[model samples]
Target: MQYLPIFTKLDNKPVLVVGGGDVALRKCRAFLKARASVTLVAPEFCSELLEHASNNEVILTQAYFDESHLDGKMLVIAATDNESVNNTVFELANKRNVFVNVVDDQPKCTFIFPSIVDRDPITIAISSAGTAPVLARRLREKLETLIPQHIGPLATLVGSFRDNVKARFKHFADRRQFWEGVFDSSVVSKVQVGDTQGATAQLHGMLDAKAEPEGEVYVVGAGPGDPELLTLKALQLMQQADVVVYDYLVSDEIMDLVRRDADLICVGKRLGNHSVKQEDTNQLLVNLARQGKKVCRIKGGDPFIYGRGGEEVQVLAQHDVRYQIVPGITAAAGCSAYAGIPLTHRDHAQAIQFVTGHCKKDGQELDWPSLAKPNQTLAIYMGVLKSPHIQAQLIKYGRDASTPVAIIENGTRKEQRVVRTHLGDLAQQIEQHHIVSPALLIIGEVAALHEQLAWFGSSAQISSFAQPLTDVA
Candidate 1:
C-alpha cells in the first residue's frame, strides 16, 4: 500500500494550508469541518476565504509560500497550482515530522485525501492509495447508496448500549451472541425504517432475555441479481446469521449487504463443478447449529426451485435443528418482471409452469406434451444449453412453432439483457445475443408481452400498457 488508512482526530488541532485558490479553499473547508484552527498563506485570497479571515474564522498570511508556515502545525496541505511550491511544502512538512498532503501530487505528499462517506460518527473512507482517485470516488458513490442514511444515529444507539450489554452478559461469546441477536431482531430493522421507539423497545426486550434460546438456522434466498429484490425476511435472517454459506451465483452486492463480521464460507457449485460436496455442506450446517450458531444457507434466487433447499431442510429435520425458510424473488419471477415479460396473462397464457431442463442419471423424459399445451407459459430454468432439444421435443409433442420466446441474461443485474424471438429460432437468437448463464428462457404467448412491457432493458422501450405494479410492503 502506498498510503496507510487512518482516521486523525483533528478537533482543536492547528492545520496549515499553503494556497488560496479553489483547491486550497477545499482543504481549508475540510479542516474547518473537522473543527481545526486553520492558517492559510498565499499571495492572494478568494472572496470566501477573505470573508472567513475578516470574521476571525481563519488566520491568513498574505504572502508567498514559505517554510515558516510549517511551524507548530499538526497537519499541512500544499494545494498550490505550482508543482514546485507544492514540492517545497512537502519537504518542509517532512523535515518537521508533520503529516502533509500535496493536492493532486501523490508522490510528493506524506498523506493523500480519501473519498470520504461521512455519516458523522460512522464515516467510511475509500482510497486507491493515489493510484486511481477516480476509481476510489466511484467505489465511494456505490457504498454511499448501499449504506442507509440513518446508520449514523443507529450506530450511536448501539454504542450507547455496548457497555450495558458487556456487563449484563459476562461470557465473551455470550455477549457477542447477545449483540448479534439484538441486531438481527427488529431493533436494527426498525432503526433503518425510521422507527427509533420500536428499535429501543426491541433492544430492551433483547437485553431482558436472561437465558435466550440457542441460535437457529435460516435458509435464505438472495433473490435474482439485485440486492434490493431481497425480501425483508431474507435481510432480517442475514443480519442475524452467524455464518453464511453462499453460492457462486449470489452477486457481490448481496454478499456485501451481509454483516461484516459474519463468517462467510463459499460452498458455491459452478455449473458442473462443486467446490465442496453437498454432503459436506449439510454436515457443516449441522455442526454450526449444534454450536448454537445462527447459520444462513444463502442461495441465489428462490431456495427451493433448483436449489437443494428441500434436501437441506430434510437434513435439519432429521437432526431436529431449529430453522426457517425465507423465500426470495425466484429467478423466473424476477427475470420476467425486469425483462418486461409476463409469465401469464388471461389474453395469452392462462397458466405458468417452472421446469428444470436437467434430469437425473437414469434419463427419464419430462412431461413435454403437458408443458407444450397452449395458453400456458413455460419458464425453463437451467435450460440454455438444452434449448434445441427442448424446442425439438416440444415441437414433436405438438407445441406451436410460432410461440414467442424471450431469453433473459444476467436476469435483473445491471448488465442484464433480453432477446425476443420465436420458439423456432430460440437457440439462434440466444447465440446472437451472446446470452450467458444464470439466464432463463420464457416461452409462450405471454412472452410477446415483453414487446409492450420491456422496461428494464435500455434498448427496449416501455409500451403504453406498461404500468407500475402495486408496491409490496
Candidate 2:
C-alpha cells in the first residue's frame, strides 16, 4: 500500500493551514468539518475564510507563512499557489514531525485527504495516495449511488441498543449473532419506513430470544485470472463471508477481495498435487457451516466448468448446508476474448467444445472422432501436459494437422502470453515456450484470429508469435 489508510480523529485537535486563497479556504473547511481547531496564516484571506473567521470558527492571521506558524500544530496543510512557500512549509512541518499535506504535490505530502462518502457517522474515505485524485473522486461518486441512505440511521438505531444487548448477552459472539438476526429480520424494514420505535421494539424482542446464527456457503467463481471478470454477486458474497475456502486456481487478486477479517484456508488443488483431498474439502465445508460460519468456497473460472464446483455443491446439498452459487466467466470465454480468438466464428467455426486435458481417475478417454470434426473450436483447459497425445489423437481422427492453434499462458492476466502455431506443432510450441499450468489451448481455424484481432497483450509479446502456418503432412 502506497499510503496506509487510516481514520484520524481531529476533534478538538489543533491544525494549521498555510494559504489564504480558495485552496486554503477549502482545506480549512475540511478541518472545521472534523471539529478541529484550525488556524490559517497568509498575507491575505479569501472572502470565505474571512466569513469563517468572523463567525469565530477559524483563527486567521494576516502574515506570510514561516516556521513560527508550525507551533504546536498536530497537522498542517500547504494549499498555497506558491511552490517555494509550500516547500518551505512542508520541510519545516515535516522536520517537526507534524503530519503535513502539500496540496497537489504527492511527493511532498506526509498526509493527504481522501474522497469521502459521508453518511453522517458512517464515513467512507478513499484515496489514491494523491496520484489520481480525480479517479478517487469518481469512485466516491459511484459509491454514493450504491450505499443506501438508511444505513446511517440503521447504525444509529443499532448503536443506541448496544449497551442493552451487551448486558443481555455476556459473550461477544452471542451479541454478534443477535445483531445479525436483527438486521436480517423486519427491524430493517421498520427502520427504513421511519418506524424507530417499532425497530427498537423488534430489536429488543430479538435480543430477548437470543437466536442462534445460521451458517451458509457461497460457491463463488473467481473468474479466469482477472479480478474484474468476477460477477457482482460473487464479489458481494466474498466480502460478506466469515471464512474463505479457496483452491490454487483462485488468483491472488481475487483472494484480496475477500473479507479482510475472514479466515482464509487454502485447500490446494494443482494438476498433480493436492494440498487437501476433494473429500476432505467437502467435509471441511460441511463442518465449517455446521459451526454457523459463512464460508466462501472460491474457485477460478465458472465453478461448474472444470472447477469441480458441482461435486462440492452436491456434497453441500447432501448435508443440507445452505449455499448460494455465483457463476464467473470461464477461461474458455475469458481467455479467448482477451487473446482475440473468438471461440465460435461465422466462417471459421460453427460449433465449440470445452475440454479438459486431465482425465478422470477411472481413465475415461476423450471422444477423438467428435472432437476432431471440422468447423469447430475446442477450448482445452489444463491441456499443456497432454498436448502431444491430444494433437496425435485429433490428427489420427481426421482433423487437419495444419489447423491453427493458440496456447494462452496465464490467460486474462497482465503477464498473459499467446503462442500461435498449427495443430501438428502443438506439443512442440508448448515445449519450446516452456508453457505452464493454468494455460488454455484454443484449437481450430478461429485460433488464427489471435494474430488478426489480438488486442490485450503488449506489442512485442503479441507480435512475437506471428509465425505463418505451414501445411503439415
At residue 147, candidate 1 shows an lDDT of 69
Tens digits of per-residue lDDT for model 2, 280-344: 99999999988878889999999999988999999999999877888999999999998888899
Alpha carbon RMSD to native, model 2: 9.4
Local lDDT at 226 for model 2: 80
Give the TM-score (vs. native) of candidate 2.
Answer: 0.62
Q: What is the C-alpha lDDT of each candidate?
A: 0.83, 0.86
lDDT of 1 by residue, 195-274 (tens): 78867766776788743435557899899978889976687668767799898989998999887799999998876788
TM per candidate comes to 0.56, 0.62
Q: In model 1, which runs have C-alpha deviations exceeding 4 angstroms?
A: 1-213, 457-473
Worst 10 residues of 1 by lDDT: 464-473
